[model samples]
Target: MKIFLAQQNYHIGNFESNTEKICCAIDLAKKDGADLIVFSELSVCGYPPRDFLEFNDFINKCNEAIDIIRKHADTIGVIVGAPDRNTVKEGKDLFNAAYFLYNKEIKGIAHKTCLPTYDVFDEYRYFEPAYHWNVIEFKGKKLAITICEDIWNLGDNPLYRICPMDKLMEQQPDLMINISASPFDYTHEQDRKAIIKANVVKYKLPMFYCNGVGSQTEIVFDGASLVFDKNANLCGQLPMFQSKLEGFVLNDDGSIDGPIITQAKDVPDTDLNPIGLDEHLNIADIHDALVMGIKDYFGKMGFSKAILGSSGGIDSAVTLALACTALGSENVRAILMPSQYSTGHSVSDAEQLSKNLNNPYDIVPIKNIYDSFLSELKPIFKDLPFSLAEENIQSRSRGNLLMAIANKFGYILLNTSNKSELATGYGTLYGDMAGGIGVLGDCYKMQVYALAAYINRDKEIIPTNIITKAPSAELRPGQKDADSLPDYAILDKILYQYIERRQGPNEIKAQGFDAALVDRVLKMVNLNEYKRNQFCPIIRVSPKAFGVGRRVPIVGKYLS
Candidate 1:
């Protein structure tokens, strides 16, 4: 049978758009003489329709879309994902299910067996896991279908007690197909291939995976839809971060023969399978993922313009360049808000960056604004020395001006605070951290520099001075970041140890770090939970990002 994999972008809660895209893919597959077409998980209502699944009207709309899709399943078979209503009074009121439709009729239904509940997925809250396993008989072939997390429960130390594939294997299925809405991290692409290969090895059958592609808010689905022979050799893979419909001819022996990949456009057929491990490890992949995240966030939210406070620092410069790339250069605006402590080179560097990108900019000097705030608060701080409060006032001044411009012009303020600053409370709250969205909140300071170098790989997109200059907040004179915080080289390592690896101070100190410094850094990260709690939603590129993925208690004891 010739199977077509539809790796398409889906907008949550937009039934019309999602159905239209699905039907278009179906028509293309039928025209290509495809016997069957497969779509990714939750393609009807979009993945992680989070809380939108609660409304009965939402499920009704899904039913309506499924009905429309059923009508189009004439002559060609369709395997699509959608939420089905659970008729029983017990358990959750829904089942995350896949419908097999052929000859304009619903052939069979395969409910998802495993419901992932941790870290960004709360499927168990809405879905009831399947109690029975059965392979669907279609076109003289036994098909074992699974959803995103079903085949994940494998290997020596598996997540679940029972493997879904093990049960399906008992039915002696011909070929396996899994639909997924897997999100992208820099390290996930390779890990994903490894996991799929492991499944192919365990089942000893050919596998086809159709993954959704697009940025769904913070989650980015890199749609490199893949196919593997019975021996786990990768035979076909769709492009990453794109929408494409590709066909593959499956042999009767549960292997693919002469797979062909075709895109939505008029591109000729190609036999290239672009699933190399080297591609995911490249830093450029991180850059592309962040750009796609920013583009889709604005596109999905219906925002056209972006405004940010560019301090001529690497963080803001990178943010502006990325925003310009995502939302056109004409749509990105920069505000250089220099305070009393601002350096001459800082303003010039920022201007050079804006000029290079051809992005519009306005100079908003906040030295006077800082003076006004200081004058107003002089009585309360008459005897106090110039300290953090005064330093943060300058930051707040810049933030206020940028926010005002964003609000007045209907522009979204992009936060430029990097992950290192956020980890150690180096950023000011309600100040530089004020924004509608955080662009680099998950990127470490070193990664920010790497991104700067990558952005300027072909040409000098970011000014050299900005990339080479000492990182600073310019809140006070001679205010290098290292004065208040540890060196980024040391700080990022410690932060990753504690935040990503969940290593305690004692554990990190044993790894050649100073005991005192480890304690201090961990304390800072724990104490600043309240600030992060109030921060904007970040475009996540890391495995353990702040906000939704990493949940910490604001009032919890520090150094625990």
Candidate 2:
């Protein structure tokens, strides 16, 4: 049997476009003489339709799309994911399901059993777990199909009690096929490959996995789909961060008729951890993910141009370089906002960066604007000492100038605040934090430096001075980040333990972190939840990003 995997980029709520893409792939697969073609989960209405799943009209549109797609499934078998209505009326109103279409009719349906509700997944909120399990038989091949999280229950300490593949084994299936819309993190590619290999080894059945590729807001789905032989040897794998349709020949002897694309390796024994500040670790993948995130965010939202305040700091330099790469250099504009405290080298460094990338830029000094705001507030505050108020005025003045230019030129402002600053509440609200999207919010300061190195790997894109200069906001005279916050080398580790690992203050301190420093960092993180809660949507590259995934209270007093 010949099978084709379609790793596609889907737009949420765009039924016409999604259906058109699906039908086009089906046509191509048929022309290539494929017996079965598979698409990722929720390919109909797009993955994580979120609250849009509640509307009856949304589900109706999804059903309408399925009807249109089934008409093209006459010659080849089609497997796609969508929400199926639950007439049983016992649990949730819908079941996340995979539809098997053959002979231009609904051949069979396999509902997803595991509804993941942790870290960026809220499937249990809108979907009901499958009450029954069965394998879909097509062309004399008994195919056991499951959704993304269904096969993830293979480890010793599994999240779900029932494994869908184990139940389907009752009928003695010949092959396994799983559809997924899994999001990308640095470590997820290896983790996904290991789990699929484990499932193949356990069931002794050749498995084919298809995953979606695209960025839906903060989440990025990397479509590196895989196919493994019955012996758990990886026969073929699709490319990452790309939309591809690849075909493979599966023989009746439980062997895939193709050279091994990669050798299966032992799975890592630890949970996904960002061990310290290793800059070179998975830096290339992170770079690609951020570029894709920027490209998709602008493309899907009908945005063509991007604008950002290009401070000479590492954060903004990396953001500007990435923006230029994603949305051609011509479309990305850089506004160099220099204040009274800004050094002459800072402006020159930013100018050199734009020149290196060949992107257009302008110099906009905010000293006069800062002075005007202070003039207006001097009457209210007669003799107040110089403090954060004066410093934030400069920062907000730059933000205002950038926004005004962005509004006049139809450009979306990109925020350049890194994760380290956001975690410690070191950023001023509506100042450096104002933008349409946060580029480096999920990346730590060390990670931003690493990205700068990667961007300059081939040629000197970012200036060397920008990479080596002492990091500062330039809000006050000679103000460095170390004035208020601890060193990034020490700070990022503690933040990773508390935020990503969910370690408490005591647990983090026990890892040789200073107890006083741990308490202070945790308090800063807890107290800054309110600030991060109101900030723009951050491009998530980490396991536990600050957006919809990590939920914390604004008024609660845990460590604060």
Candidate 3:
């Protein structure tokens, strides 16, 4: 038996583009004369569509994509994943499902028995569990097909409890197929291989595991497809986070041999360019992911474009640059909202940076907005002493403008906050926090600067002025970020240990930090959970991104 695996990289919510990529894979599989081809989970609309699935139009668009692939079902058989609606009375509205597609028909829906609800996953919030596990006899072979989390049968988690593998093996299926969106941690692939080995050995069957690649806001699926034989030995393996095709031939006894990796090449070591949050090793793959995230975020959310306040600082510069790269240059609007405290170099830097990035931007000069807010508040606190409230007002005013323009033109507002600033309470809630989505909320300020240098490694896209200029909010005269917070160098180091490493105050203090400094920093991080909870969606790059994965109670008294 000749089976082909499509390790595709899907862009979140970019159904039209993803469909074309899927079609290309199908054609390749057909040319190779493979009887069947398998794709990753949610290959139709991309995995973890998040709030996009909440929209009827987005779901309908995904259905449209499936129908498009269905037209060519006669030449190439496909096992694909998508959100399946249960036409039931008292069940969930959706189900994570896999479809056996051939001859322009959906043979059956293999519902996911395991719906993960831990950490970044919230499957229980949207899907109902499929109780039945049945074998599909296709092309002279009985097959067991499963969705992403179905293969991960451990833990007594809230979503589901049963492991169907033991029960499924009783039927003695010829082969098994798993469609997945399993993400990449440094150690994730090894664990997955162990799982596949154990399952194949247990069932004494040939199995194919196909997973998605590419980044969705805060989540990047690493496509590491694998094949295992009855002996628990890996017959073939596909590398992670790339678009590739693998073919495996089965012997008469259902024994599988080495995979012939096709339509892909080893990544050249010479190329290490700057890519976005969900970036892959390849340039095209990284570009595609960013474009899809931006396109889908806007398209799925009912917007055609977006607006961001670009301060010429690294954070805003990166945000604007990504928006321009994602949406077309004309679609992203940049406002250089300069207040009276804004430096001339900051203005020049923003304009130059905008021109270099080719984003459609303008100088709105928030001096007017800044003046109006202060004027209105002056009468209320006539005798009050000036404090952080005044600084926050400037930030709030700029945020208000960006939001108003977005509301008026149906543009999604983009937050320019970086992880360093967000780690502490440097962000002004209801001010700089007004964005619909935050592009770099998980990336530390230093890393943002590194990514900036990487993007400009070959060519200087980000000007030196923006990169070297003393980082500032410019909410007050002679204001620098260090005026209120520690230097980004020290702050990001502390944050990496505290947030990513999950180190407590004592543990961090053991690394030679002063007791007072450690306590103060940890207190800030702990106290800011409420603010982080209120923050917008942050892209997931690290293992502990600020999105769904790192959940903390707002009322918790757990001080590190």
Using TM-score as the measure, the top candidate is: 2
Clashes of each: 0, 0, 2
Candidate 1 lDDT, tens digit per residue, 333-381? 9999888799999999999999999999999898788899989999999
Ordering by TM-score: 2, 1, 3
Q: What CA RMSD would you report for each candidate?
A: 4.6, 1.2, 6.0
Tens digits of lDDT, candidate 2, 1-560: 99999999999999999999999999999999999999999999999999999999999999999999999999999999999999899899999999999999998888999999999999999999999999888999999999999999987799989998989999999999999999999878888887888888789999999999999989999899999989888898899999999999999998889687666554333345555546567899999999999999999999999999988888988999999999999999999989889999999999999999999999988878888888999998679999998988887888888899999999999999999999999998988999999999999898898999999999999999998888998888898999999999899989988887898898888899999999999999999999999999998888889998989999998999
TM-score of each: 0.95, 0.98, 0.77
Worst 10 residues of 2 by lDDT: 264-273
True-structure lDDT of candidate 3: 0.77
Candidate 1, residue 197: Cα displacement in angstroms equals 0.7
